[model samples]
Target chain A: MATTEVVVSILVSTLIGGIIIGYLSQRSRMCFVGGVRDYVLVKDTHLLKAPLAFLIGAVVVFAIASLVASMPTWPWFITKSLMPIPGAPLAANAAVPIYNHIILAIIGGLGIGIFAVFAGGCPLRQHVMASEGDKSSMLYLLGFYIAAVVFMAFILPNIQIF
Target chain B: MTEQKERKRIIKHSYLIIIAGLVTGLIAALLQITAGVGPPNAPVAYGICIACHGRDLINWIVNAIGGTNLGYGTLVAGVPVLTVVGIVAGAFISSTKNKEFKFRTTKNPGVSFVCGFAVMASALILGACPLRAVLRVAYGDAIAVVGFIAISVGVVISAAVIKVNARRAINREVT
Candidate 1:
């Protein structure tokens, strides 16, 4: 297909996929951080099951897809290095070392975990909540979208600290 | 509809999540197979992510309308992924249909904003949100596994902190 067609198809497929996931997410109040927090605090498996299910489902589907298609990086751990999949920073500059990627991942993980917990839901959950007319979640998304621009433009450039 | 039929129609949350996951995986893979969205341009597991896709979508719009060359994933250089938009629309439809949509307001707007800002910053650092982190791990990215462990550790700590705070509040009330 042509470029415009490819873009349109991607947009359509992703929109449909997102809508389905979002509908289910709103019904279930699915939150990954909430899942981990609930299980950690109370040993509750109700929400935890969603992330587990998602992992298993994605893994199984991806495995099936790999059989038919030639994905050079299907199993990234085997084909690529053990480094985390390159984020914007690493993606921009491939020369960043593996250890740096690990460090970044740890820092990022901790921050995401702590803040998401404090904010009351994961990003997806927040989005669902916002859609359900939660003002706080809407504010959260406002900050989220702004920060995305700030991070890409300013913060991402200065984060060379190893 | 009969109560029994309605009950049978209500799918379990686990099944819903599983279906979401499977569809997400299929979309990612199909994008690769049909549209060639991988490797050189897009990374593996580039299907669905709250943070990355939101960033790419917003920037794509900004660059298009404002004539600003804001950076975004090359995978979405042409057209922004509409997943985030769809999520909002879908959730709105679901909540409104179920009569669950309520205009709940918060006292501390700043707190929510800061939390969102920090979350996005960290997500960009980690390169994936929790959902995409799981996707990366599923695709066999070892470092993503480490990130996943760290996220779990953070959650444990947060849970402990919240527990302690709750206990403190209870103790204060008793006193």
Candidate 2:
């Protein structure tokens, strides 16, 4: 396939995937926190099933695609490279040293987890919720965008501890 | 007798939920592994991250500042925009079909906004959100595991807060 064709195909597939996933999530009323909370609060399990199903589906698709197409099977799509400082140790590949920085990783994870709970959803869940016409989720998404811009521009540069 | 039976059913359901969650995590991991390798003859991974593309945008910006190339920014931001737009469009269609479309908001807008900001900021700081984080781990990024553990700790803490608040609300109602 030509480069343009390849790009177009990928875009189309991604869109289809996102749409299908989003629709399914909405129909299922799947919220990650809600699922876990249901289990914790009252032992309800309906909401949790969708995410589990999603994960399974994703894995299966990935496996098939990897084997058939000779693609890398790891989740490189989701990995973001950390900007290494001058003194920071570099991994063999472009993998960020931050992956090895246990302390910062833990702190960052704690923040994400707590914030997700407070927001009543993770970032992905917020997207799903927004798609469902949840106004609160839209607000959350706005906040998320702002935060993303801010972190990338300002906060990330000063943190030497990580 | 009815209450006891209900409790037993609930317990059974909870087990199912746990199993489902574990399975989902594993599946997501598997997908991450497959997608990590770029598709045959393609420089880009088939399903590269929606958010990491944002980071790539930042990289482009930095490169631009350094008088380097800027062509890559479009690709970085483009995929996420398409994915999110697709998500919204899909939801709309589904809601239309199900007759579940409605504009709704919580009682407290301010709190919701704050929560949203917090969630996004935290996600940005970690370089990926929960979904991305898990995918990162699946792809063999050891750092993502730390982020996931931290996410669990955060969840527990927040859950405790919810519990306390619920208790207080119950006490107030009782009085």
Candidate 3:
């Protein structure tokens, strides 16, 4: 297929996939931050189980599909490979860029995690909620997209922080 | 006999839903990461990344408006935006069909908006959505671990604060 054709095909596939996910997520009330929050605060495994199920499902499918795609070799199983720890023999040439990964990934992840809860849900949850006419979610997406645009136009250009 | 029969049916129905969810999740993840698809119109800072999807998409729009990227990079005309749009559309359709669609307003829109800004900023910084971080890790992206651990820690810390506040509220009421 041509590049455009492939792009079209992928977009359609992604759309349908998104629809399916949207429906399933809606039906299941899939909210990631809420799941973790419930698990931690209330000892409720109920909501937490949904994300776990999705994670397991996605991981299995992704791992298999990665075989079909030309890609980088994965550097982890369940954790950062212990063998690649700084000062370890493999650390010197390890695929993991320790400094960048530590700074961006950790800080970014913490931001997403904490703010998602504060926002009441992650993007997936918020978008769907927005569609359901949740005013807060609608307001949230406004900020979400604007921040994204600003980041690309201004923040990224000035700072080489990935 | 009727109670037992109902219980069994509920369990069976739930298992079916789970299987269906798994199938759809797999298909969606597969399609999103298809190698058949070419690169975005502009130089993408990242690929197959959900957090950056919105950013790339907005950049595409900006480039389109200006008719050129002004040398920042080749700005693409599009990204995986349709998928994000599709998600909302599908959920709306499903919810409407299921009679679960409702208009709910939060008492605190300002708070939600600020939190939303933070969430977007963090996701952009991390370069992937926390939700889809699972797929990245599954692909053996070791860098995802730092984000994952940080996210979990964030959740735990917030949960602790929430519990403390709840206890404080209870004490005030009792006193």
Candidate 4:
């Protein structure tokens, strides 16, 4: 297929996949951070099982996928440089130092963890809860959207570890 | 009786989580294979992420209507990923269908909003949300592992604090 066709196909696939995921998540009440929190605080394995299964399922599928296609960048740490996968600032480039990425990951992960606990769920959970007509989650998403713009404009530039 | 119990266990919520996780992996792999990643749609494990994909979707719309070039992942350069949109739609449909949909208001909208803002800022800094972090770890990224560990630590810390506060409240009531 042509590039445009491929993009469209991927978009449709993602939408469908997302629908499946969202439906399942709603039914299951699957929240990764919640799982970790529950297990840590109460030793409740009930919620914890889902995220572990998620990790295992993804790993097994990813391993199989590598055999079917030429995943040159599949195992990114070994194939590419030690820098984390490109989802952050300078995502497409390798200009940022390795340590910067590490530091960013630490700070980012901690912030997400702490705030998400207070917010009552992770991002995915918040989105689902908002859809369920939770007014608080809707407000949460409002801030989430606004912060995306603010991060790109204000926070991203200053945090560049030059 | 045992057969019925077995049937119920098979249809448990955890099973749905497992299916969702496997399907998520399959979607990511299929996108990579068919779309031919790198340029215009980079980032491995780009299938399903709440934070990154959500940001990309917003950026795509803003850039389209406002004609402003806000930077975003190359994957959504042409069209935004609709995973988050689909999530909301799907969740809404499922909740209503299951009669689980209810309008629940919060006492602390401002606090929730601030927490949301902070969560997004940190997630972007890390460059992935929890779901994406798991994907990266599965894809063999070492840094994501560190991030995951730090996230666990943070969760533990907060959970402990919350537990302590709850206990204190109980103690005060007893007094």
Task: Between candidates 1 and 3, name the one with more favorable TM-score.
Answer: 1
Using alpha carbons, what is the TM-score of model 3? 0.80
Candidate 1 error regions (>4 Å): B1-37
Most DockQ-accurate candidate:
4
How high is each candidate's TM-score? Answer: 0.91, 0.70, 0.80, 0.91
Stretches of candidate 3 off by over 4 Å are A62-97, B1-17, B32-50, B66-81
Writing each residue's lDDT as its tens digit, candidate 2 over A4-88 gives 5545654565466556655655555556555555565567667657455545545555556566765443444333443211111
Candidate 1 collision pairs: none
Calculate model 3's interface RMSD in Å: 5.3
- Give the per-residue lDDT digits (tens) of candidate 2, residues B1-175: 9999999987776555545444444433332233222324222322323344434444455556676432222242233224455556777788878888777877777777888777756655555566656455444455666766677678778888888999999999999
lDDT of 3 by residue, B96-139 (tens): 99987889978998888888788877876665676656555544
Interface RMSD of each: 2.0, 5.8, 5.3, 1.9
- What is the lDDT for B126 in model 3? 67
- Candidate with the larger TM-score of 2 and 3: 3
Selected candidate, larger DockQ, 2 vs 4 = 4
TM-score of chain A of each: 0.92, 0.69, 0.78, 0.90
DockQ of 1: 0.65
